[model samples]
Target: MKFFKTMFALSFITALFIVGCAVQQPVQPIPDFSPTTFNSNDYVSALDNFLIILDASSSMDDRYNGNKKFVTAREIVKHLSQTLPELGQNAGLRSFGHSPKVSDKLTVLFYGMEEYTQKGLNEKSGLVSRAGGTSPMHTALTAAREDLKTFSGKTAVVIISDGQEAMGLKLPITLEAAQALKNQMGEDLCFYPIFVGDDEKGMHLMEEIANIGKCGFVTKADKLMTGSGMGQFVQDVFLTKKPMVQAPAPTPIVATPPAVEKAWVVGEAYFDFDKSIIKPAGFEFLDKVVDVLKSRPALFVKIQGHTDSIGTRKYNDALSLRRAKAVKTYLINKGIDKNRLSCEGFAFSKPVASNKTAEGRAMNRRVELYPVTK
Candidate 1:
């Protein structure tokens, strides 16, 4: 009886182990980030060259918030690539971990120290397949120092990692490497470290590395995954706001005839699908309109909102009105008199472009400004 009981217990234990091994944790889906188009007229590239250091060490295979850290890190790079405007800057991507199939080296430069393009960077980022091997972050940084040497301009070093290294390893080695890179690049080098996990030690390590660069800031992967978050990050890293030139003082008054009635369709301002918020790309056009309105206080302007024919008429009507009001509110906040502005919503009634194609739909979702003689 005792022997039978022992056999049954062993069988049960074996079954339990097999069940645990068979069940895999489901990875969460990364939310799609709608990148905002940045107008070149309002900003210029801040850095001449930039390098992205991604961590693909074995540790990244571990899951954080239901998704593998490696996947999240890769997504962050892709989204950043999409958000960054092609302003003729040099770019490169390096990975610390070895994917046995792709490379046998401890570190590899996957992409350019060449001119940056949204498509080119994304294709190279996709080439980094699997994550395996120890974190040799110091070695990657050392190679990156050499990578930066090939180009001359203000540069940014963006490191994306979980901040965890091999057990029993001394931490100072990583910092020393970062410091050395900084010493080589001098004031032109900035460090932007993106922490990928919730590990406290990892966060601190990433923060310390950024501190060493002295010119950049630290952010988390989850925050950068969002559309607005990535947009702000890109704006901070790559572009500097062009100084707003003040309108020249009005010339001594020569009596001018009443301004001819005019209408301006701000097709230059494009809206994201199903979104009503004014994008940064649209701000420059609106600011010019603000100058126009302020200069013509006697003119009453009508703000017209339109939308693509995707939703029901009733829903599109409300959406369009909300869009109109959004522009109206923006104008009011900019010190335009509320009494002079009126809003109207034309929901798919006016087709500036065909609703069948995406390009046409984007053009359809726009605001028009009409100035009337008071």
Candidate 2:
């Protein structure tokens, strides 16, 4: 009887061990699909025509930060053209620096969006390689305006230049031509200038162009023209619905008494050129502000919007307000009190950084948050 009992006990123990092993089977992890399809067609599409005007002037040959400006611009244009879904929208390519004759002026490299049936950007064969001369930016603007004349949809002209109008055919003539074009086009078309270098004079020219064209101006290169910058630009233009403007750098935070009755958090949020909506990556930082407001139940925040010295002051001012309100709304949705927040737009009147370099302009486009404790 004892032997039989021992056998039963051992079998039971073995069975329990087997059950334990079965229960210990590893849990398979779910593959992350966020990065893969983050920008996929999950949201409603806002299709718009993109005209990429590249500055292929010899000056573009100059190294910016490290890479050649022209090369970086080409990479950005090509990637956006290929990756962004067709959505019934087309991309046009033009250049200002390459003319068979120095006087030929800004040449149309690729006219409008055509089906991409070729390999690479055809660097050696395209007008980019063939273009080497003075930059006729104004002429390029005129040509771009003409190109958009036929299309009735939303048109955006993206000029990627080093911001130097010095070597152009004639400065006064070009400026006059651009202004005339703007007068003819009215507000139907948008012009966005992405200055590549850090020349103050060049940035001023770009700012002038933006003012005349009533569009956004961006000066800077982020992360070597990888898809992120392009994506940010596109998102800013379409999603946020805020017109682009140049702004100043953020002011330093001043020390104040902790018992100060009230304070207002005011700041502007910067977006990619021609883009209005905030990128997802920036959401975390923005959310922190909301969290702070939630923690301080008695504190009220006022958001002030500002733009760099670009585009019409009226438009920038309005856009700045809209951008600030957008943030306020976002915070409200995140559980902050709407009544506690107020928004104001300052336009290009306030500038913290010189709008000369690409980096400086980026610093200009931002939202200011102030706390009001009264």
Candidate 3:
């Protein structure tokens, strides 16, 4: 009995010590909200051209939870590139603290000012590896200014950072560089700064950077972890359609002619990513299309299926065809004559929107209904 008690006491003490050690680790608090999807296409018109200025400083080595700050940042940027609307605009990726030994070195532009492609952006984003040395954020910003010297339209300068200035640096030059860039670009430039970790000073610094650009805004990485949050961010940035105020004078209404032109706008049936089966909402949409097709029996309907630019052309071609078949089957089940529904898979060949963007790709990945009048 005495031996058993002694062994139990020792085991209990060992367990307590182990538990204590585990408790000493820093705890990363979970965000208030989390949702699954944050597809970038939902917010289409954020910017025509932009650069993702990623911080690769030594500070990113710190752990937010179990994951490194730099790792989280890389993932965020990768996802951002994947989802961002690619409306055939120029975009690029630039990194700071990549070359620590070289002080005078400018920020490296791994991507482009060329037509933005999701795959290209992702490849560039992945180029950033381990973080080292001081944060040369201002220098990076200056280099970015130079990079955009040739760009004419409104540009988005997106900086992802922990907000730490260069090591042992006294006065920060971020605001100065930002102002310089703003002056050069005028109203045509916007700055969006995202905080990678919960650094109060860093958040403040980022907010200041955002303030420098009248058109830009500040955000936190955590805020966009969930799909809904990401959607909200995209909406605020892209879907920039302003609300209309009621005018004192009402607009005049025009009456329609009895004989309308054969020109019919058949709304698109959108497909979810890699999905051929129509959703409940899509089915409802098809109901209206069915009615239109039934009313105009003389009109032959063409169902063209298309895929986004993510997959190989051959694979996408097959996928696109499957989508068209799915739509055709759905329509046939809904009492539409098989002869009236002619389906064709255009794949990614004939894209209405640029495949470089999420929204553009979303627009492209659809079964478009066009009335064929021979």
Q: Candidates' TM-scores?
A: 0.63, 0.48, 0.55
Candidate 2 vs 3: which has more TM-score: 3
Candidate 2 RMSD to the correct structure:
26.0
lDDT (Cα, tens digit) per residue for candidate 1, span 58-140: 99999998899999999999899888988778899999875788678999999988989999999999988888888999999
By lDDT, the candidates rank as: 1, 3, 2
Task: Please give the TM-score that candidate 1 achieves against the real structure.
Answer: 0.63
Residue-wise C-alpha lDDT for candidate 3, range 95-118, written one tens digit per residue: 888545523344678788788887
Residues 207-250 of candidate 2: C-alpha lDDT, one tens digit per residue = 77777777666646543255565566655553322233433434
**CA lDDT of 291 in candidate 2?**
68
Error of 1 at 225 (Å): 1.1
- Global Cα RMSD, each model: 16.9, 26.0, 14.6
- Each candidate: what lDDT? 0.83, 0.61, 0.71
Q: TM-score: which candidate is best? A: 1
Residue ranges of candidate 3 with Cα displaced over 4 Å: 1-44, 99-106, 239-374
Model 2 lDDT on a 0 to 1 scale: 0.61
